[model samples]
Target: MIINKILNVDDYYYDVFMAISESLTGFSVNELQSTGLAETYYQHILNQIEMATFIDFLNVSKNVLDNAENKDQLKNAISSQIMDNPATQQIAQSVITLWYLGTWEGAYVNDRSYKEGLVWNVMHAHPPGAKQPGFKSWETKPVNSNS
Candidate 1:
């Protein structure tokens, strides 16, 4: 059923997403299940879909390649629903790659790194070959009654 929809998609967002995910991760559905990584990944995608840069990139990529005009209507409909998110930005990159390149590799020239985002920043990761630790280890924060 998804393949049919993808075939019909002249615009191909969903298809691009699938292609990129497979290419970047090199994992099959069975592998994802075995690793129990699906739930964690789904949540990450949810967050990235909320970033502004990500949404703009996805729209730009989709529109730039559409020449058939077959995708115009769907594009317009999806435009308003577009969510620009950092969390989803990486995923969007893969989709864009699949749309342009026959196959998906990582992202395009942008070269997004897991090293740059909230995951690394908030946690205070140390640079490679650091002389000292970047962040001090911490215990859980205590609850407050200010609420």
Candidate 2:
């Protein structure tokens, strides 16, 4: 997915976020991007940023993540970046939670209505209202699997 630059925030920010997210969550950047993870979680944070302070904070955080020598260093680098301020720490926590739970708890309706949330993939099941099995089907084996 192509991540367009937002104001002063460029694709570099996306790259940095992807790296930090992968290091923190143990999920590949490709997997996150494939499911529009950042679009749902990271973009919400960016959407709320309307000041130079937050922009600068993000840039500094990106720089820290970019310069890390390895995965552990990358995690440490982003952690320190977040620990610099309460606001940043909150954003970091939100990002981590979103990556793990596939929803932002701050919102009233955090449904994966678009069918892109990680929960569907991880559970090997469809979303609650989507593609439910027929009645009583769950009690019987699928014919194809009855070898």
Candidate 3:
């Protein structure tokens, strides 16, 4: 789908997108921003859906963020207002996929996206053949391993 409008860095919708992403992904804004792909993912979604649908999704997201006063309330709001809502479910899932796996609808977004996937961090590992730990680094125990 062609985006009727492209959001700039300073756009209000961009902020809304990041805020929603943080809530949806269980990551802080700093962690999401650290990936350097937040804007790219936002634009990717715009490229893949109708602007109206995207806007509606953002509106729902913004409302959820605005009304929820605590983490539990935010989680409930997102589950009800975004994840379970037919109009926003697919997009919300796509966002989660994009962050965790660096893929949208099964296609990798980019080499950087693949390397920077949150799944790697969550699993305490890096993408295979990317971000190599170092020569024979695996021979040593993991830093945080319980063993």
Top model number, lDDT: 3
TM-score: model 1 vs. ground truth: 0.26
Inter-residue clash pairs, candidate 2: none
How do the residues 104-137 of candidate 2 rate in per-residue lDDT, one tens digit apiece? 5555225552356555566665567755756886
* Backbone N/Cα/C clashes per model: 9, 0, 0
- Residue-level lDDT tens digits of model 1 in 1-147: 022233333534444333334333344334333433333343344454555554455444444333224345534433333225454444555543333332235432222222222223224453344223435433424244253
Off by over 4 Å in 2: 1-10, 40-42, 51-54, 83-87, 108-115, 119-127, 130-147
Whole-structure CA lDDT of model 3: 0.85
Q: Model 3 clash pairs? A: none
Order of the predicted models by lDDT, top scorer first: 3, 2, 1
lDDT of 3 by residue, 1-147 (tens): 111222357667888888888777888777988998988888888898899999999988888888888889989999998989998999999989999999998999988999999998888887898898889987989868888
**TM-score of candidate 2 on Cα atoms, chains taken together:** 0.59
Off by over 4 Å in 3: 1-8
lDDT at 123, model 1: 42
